[model samples]
Target chain A: MRSRSCIDERAARKAQPALRKVGRGASGRGHGNAVPLPGPASGRRDQRRGMPPMMRWETRDEICELVLADEPCNEIGTHMLEALERFVAEARKLPARALVIRSEVRSGFSAGADLRELYAGILTRPREEHVPALRSFLDRIHAVMDALDTLPMTTIGAVHGVCFGGGFELALTCDLLVADRTARFGFPELRLGLIPGFGGIPRLRREVGNAVVRDLLLTGRTINAKKAATLGFVSQVVAPGEATDVARRMAAQAARFDRDAAVTAKAFLKPLPREELAREKEHFVRLFQNPCVTEALRRFVESKDVRPYLP
Target chain B: MSDTVTRLMALAARRFKADAAKLRAEADFFETLGIDSVQALELLSELELEFDVEIPDYELQGVKTFTALAERIDKRR
Candidate 1:
């Protein structure tokens, strides 16, 4: 029989190499210099400057940055979509046993579509170009989310502040979501006179009940972490500053298991049926036809200067 | 000496290792060898199936080493 002391010593030995890999000082390359700024601070500055934050990779299987940062409006553009796709692809290839995803923004995980990009696409591009551009962007976004979902590993979303629109969809694709007490989650696309174009509607409905998904999406209302947990949207809700730690712990635990089973299990549990997906597509078409959506689009157009729209 | 544990571990090690030299003892979890969280979870899932145990999220957060995890599995068994 293995004595407890012997087990503890073996565990420590097994864990030591991984721990050493964890706290390695940030490499001073690329945007790693930006590490000094907290996620919120960087987000705010990027918002002011009107540019997307440079996505940065840390040593211990973590990715941070505001994807759309300061871009034209709050809309995700082709460039940003490509960057995200690349990140997801690269992350899938990393040697880590699990992956943790977090945001740099303080009040909003992502404010949905970049309005400036949308406005530009609408105003400058021909009417015929609109659908193709939108579809292309959606496809790329779907690829990223799909990669996150099907990667042969454990994925955890460490959510704090606000997770809305596309950000909410991103979190939903993760295997687990660990949210901070201050975390706010929602799908306000309907209020904007649009549906969640990037797979948010079906994923949200599958995560929470249809009722909660209906209430949140149709009303464009926000739910706090506690409420989200009650509705089964959030896996765990920690103190405001504790999300990263909790995510790390979860990642650490995931690191100890077998990879094939994890991938197979995830593939098996995906809840979106073809019928539901078809219905969601119809909902998107109807939502774009609504006057509420038109007015919401107008509001989105007008709100360009408002720092970050906290959910 | 369950075939399940040995097979699961072998698969995990093969997926995680970049070179032949990296594979270590059964006690060496992938994380210690520079395996990321996603890879770790992939490994965990195999163990979950072999042991028929649902690893709770909280316990998942606490696992740091293979020996610690193996013991946890042993207890459940």
Candidate 2:
């Protein structure tokens, strides 16, 4: 079985220093450089100055709300991953008692991994550099997921529209998932001949039953919010366009609890499935090495089918 | 046309704001509704909620018409 030790030390080492920098370093590429968004109570105009285009956050009344606004369904790519890393680091330093992650994009919360970008990387980079590069990317994203998973405060994902693949994994990191009637959850990685690379399988299995996990992963079918709620993963299913409001209320309630008691309970109930997550990453890297993944990604990116997002 | 087809067409028109009279059973829903894949998923969700049936996305693969979609829902019902 491939393990963390099997990963290239050189590539892993290269990612460590960058991860350490956390928020804006001397290079001014961190949260410090992000545009200051108006807090929920501020009623101030949004200031988009210098904000990373992928994400932005505001804190008020000891609550932090981060908005994912990347265009075209908020596909997670290098830009989004970097933005998330910055958010994760900044979240640790905040005085917030609860965090709410929501999306402002019209289409959905997020469509998933940016297959076009992945395909582009594959075509532009040499085959020898592929696995190492992929592993590094996975490592960085996993770190963000781990950090979010273990944050001292309560976290809620206000989901709507498409939450598939990497996006589904990201939502799974939340302490609670609040999906609107319009929200849909899916794992379509199998269609591309790859597993969910962003620590999805382990987190999903932890939240829902093994049967539900197998159904979504193996069939590669998307499920609507009502169906997801019935399966017991989604904590609440609000009316359409009301997920964020419901999430904000949940955050408020969570913030009212004793911090230490809440943190302890969270730690005990939702310990990170570290071993499984590591194995999942290794499995993803192994599967990604196959040529079929590349070809499948190519077909996805190049396809003109109006229903390409469907099975 | 079957009642299922008629109701399906009506639902699509209401969800997508299309002209119910203009919606033909055989017409491609993608073209008739002027929607892409994402909107198609939204339509799928509406269908599930309306019909109270779970339609795996794969079941709708290559299905692009109102009558065909109704048949899928009918089988589930």
DockQ for all models, in order?
A: 0.01, 0.41
TM per candidate comes to 0.60, 0.86
Alpha-carbon DockQ of candidate 2: 0.41
lDDT of 1 by residue, B1-77 (tens): 45444554566566565443444435446444565332343345445555665443235435555555666667666
Error of 1 at B18 (Å): 56
True contacts kept of 2: 0.56
Candidate 2 residue-wise lDDT, A1-311, digit = tens: 11111111221112111111122111111100001111122122233234335567787887888888765666676657777877887788788889999999877887777665566667766778777778778888899989999999999999998898888888999999999888988988888787887888899899889999999888988899999889988999988899999999999999999999989999999999999999998888888888898787656655555666554
Clash pairs, candidate 2, are: A24-A30
Compose the digit string of candidate 1's lDDT tens values, residues A11-100.
121111110111111110010000000011112222323223434444343322223332111224343455566666566556666777
List where candidate 2 sits over 4 angstroms from the true fold. A1-52
Give the interface RMSD values of the models in order.
15.0, 8.8
- As a whole number from 0 to 100, the lDDT of residue A151 in candidate 1 is 70
- Cα deviation of A246, candidate 2, in Å: 0.6
Against the true structure, candidate 1 reaches a TM-score of 0.60
Taken over the whole model, the C-alpha lDDT of each candidate is 0.52, 0.76
Best by lDDT: 2
